[model samples]
Target: MTSLETLLRNTQDVKVIDRSIDYNEYIPLDLSAFNPELSKFDIKCAVSFEEFIEKHLTLNDAKVAFGGYNEQRNLYQRSTVFKDEKTEERNIHIGLDLWIKARTPVLSALDGKVHSFNFNAGFGDYGPTIILEHQLENQIFYTLYGHLSLDSLKDLEIGTVFKKGEQFATLGNAAVNGDYSPHLHFQIIKNIAEKFGDYPGVCSKKELPFYLENCPDPNLLLKITA
Candidate 1:
């Protein structure tokens, strides 16, 4: 089978906080307009992305984009880890963002272990992040949840066990989560490079190709409108 087929085969139905929609549900927002390169103006026209896409946006657009490749928008692009002097330009967004209000509960899409976690704080940072590892159809992979409340990772133990569709964390607001509109940055990583709690959600133009392969569209697992 082809990689596309593999991805389709691996796609899983995620248990949303209180999902009322059904399969192949039509999301409210037309985020196809949310390309990585678009300026704040373009993004706001769509909806206020809790992180990179700044400015005022409306709630008409619910159910944010999960995973799908785009050449313009960097989900975590504007988040800064520290003072500008402390780090270089922040550009890469390593995960798929689920745009919504803060405090939304994030659920585990599959049975897995708490592989690792940390509070990746900084300007435009992840705030609190969690990574869960799963073995579906004998395929070993991981899911990374970023932009969560600090309390979310307070007592999480690495390698701790969590069942599929479990409640793990809640979406945080801009004050706690990396400075952005409220949203959950979801990502699937094949190899974590020994990294815990934090990973590059976006990559430079030169590195896009590699990051794309390393981080597949989370839609495979979440089945979100990518």
Candidate 2:
């Protein structure tokens, strides 16, 4: 069987957000701990973070800001979902994030059927999440779309078919999307195990190896090089 990475690399013209916006309009964004600019503002505030994203897009003359796969971010420190007294903090982001305004159309990366859907409501959670199962090159894998609008799941059902690039959801706002800036958290899972609509999008240093192996970089499928 072909490796999932190779299969993804071989795939072409895959876009998971706003099909109307070309790749040229997408700019790489750095929300990682290494970015000094993030410390200047209150990262915990959703409205402030949205303003930061808007400024980033405008400054770069771009429409979309994308990145965060395997990035260690301080932004997660604000949520108990990532840390507590006993467990180490899961600061490393394991998915690609596309920063855009709320209501931006979210597309399916490939032809697949809805495997699960749920409203994972909580601070720093992936509210209104959806997972799709697909068979590619004789391999079964899953793609997770997080932080989606509630209306996106209003009438959605398991086994609903969505073709490549088809609009299946819309980005959710801070109010419904874990109180973070509006963006789509896109991840590719090799083995979903018993996980349903929800999956870990962040991991601690000790858990990195396992999560990294299970969740490959989403850019492999998106092919967003800029």
Candidate 3:
């Protein structure tokens, strides 16, 4: 039996997202065409890819605006969109997002139970989301899979058990997927404590250290190669 950490550090041909095909060649899609307000989503995806290229990029005081968009950003006062204020503070993305086309199979990272699921709809939102809870050696953790097709969550029920490496659902496109490029928001949470169908994937820079502690580098497990 391979340990989770071993699976993560495994330099051998290990499958990410459970049954996800080895997407050897992939090209990013332009979600801006669908919704200009979603420009920030594209921006975040671009920055994340840039950081992925650097391989060890970590910004401490970097600023990331927090707000979902259906069209284009309104340039809301430089600090907030509606009410939440943070000018020098940008919304820090905690999850590792994969930008690509839709309908890509979403695989189970490990044998876990379907903790909860929901449809978080809104421009720049996670249209469809799913969370899996896994426990090893009494240490439990959860993984959130987001930006999926609406059909993906239509009939899903809570507490459903998924075996490790199962094909759970497919990635969604801009229209149904919160009006952004097709991608997967993969995040790890150490202590969900008591949450259902929802968890924070992005946080303010003010709460970075805590988030960093709670949400470790997913690449530590992804080992992505371009």
Candidate 4:
């Protein structure tokens, strides 16, 4: 394992969502093209897609539906942001998603200062996003929180310090959060490269290897297992 991965794994009790919800209540959700169930729903519509999420949670008897790291999904086909005639479709999701109802409390994964934040307004884009810069074991990295409520960005400033588990934001609904189900798109970025508030959460197959290396699996920190 790399130094960053080891540092993340060595940490304890990391919860980015409501602290009251235990990891046991979190269930894995498959939004990939390989999931045959996705074919049944008109996922392009946020309302319909949300209904599907609600049903999935109900059936599994879980509170939160999570996953989608390095998952290739067909859901992005409706958005020109992921694909246009000139570029290859960016269908692979590189972040760990925590699917839940809107306005759920979002916490900081570790003590860090705000590197950047923005309202990336677009279809299939991260609505309100925040990236926190952290340093551990003399290594600096960043954690990105996407699909946040607008209120989360209110009164925010650069270099804002947030302690681990501190409530810094709330989840955004479909109307604001890229017109999809309410979820926190969390990623661990080793190198941000001049990007502010926003980073490419989806990548084409051709660019997968680079992204996969730069953005490691967030589960190494969350450790929410099956």
Cα lDDT, model 4, residue 96: 99
- Ranking of models by TM-score: 2, 4, 1, 3
Q: Model 2: residues >4 Å from true position, as ranges?
A: none
| Residue 224 Cα positional deviation in candidate 3, in Å, after optimal superposition | 1.7
Prediction 3 global C-alpha lDDT: 0.61
For residue 94, what is the lDDT in candidate 1? Answer: 49
Q: Per-model C-alpha lDDT, please?
A: 0.64, 0.94, 0.61, 0.95
List, residue by residue over 39-104, the lDDT tens digit for candidate 2: 888898999999999999999999999999999999999999999999999999999999999999
Candidate 1 per-residue lDDT, tens place, 170-194, comes to 8887777766667787888877888
Question: What lDDT, from 0 to 1, does candidate 1 have?
Answer: 0.64
Residue 68 in candidate 3 has what lDDT?
28
Which residue ranges in model 1 land beyond 4 Å of their true spot? 1-8, 20-71, 74-94
Candidate 3 C-alpha lDDT tens digits along 79-187? 2322254344335567777654477678777778898988887655677999989876556788898888888887788888887778888888767766555668888
Best of the two (1, 2) by TM-score: 2
| CA RMSD (A), model 1 | 4.8
Q: How many steric overlaps does candidate 2 have?
A: 0
Clashing residue pairs, candidate 3? 36-71, 36-72, 37-71, 37-72, 64-90, 64-91
Better of 1 and 4 by TM-score: 4
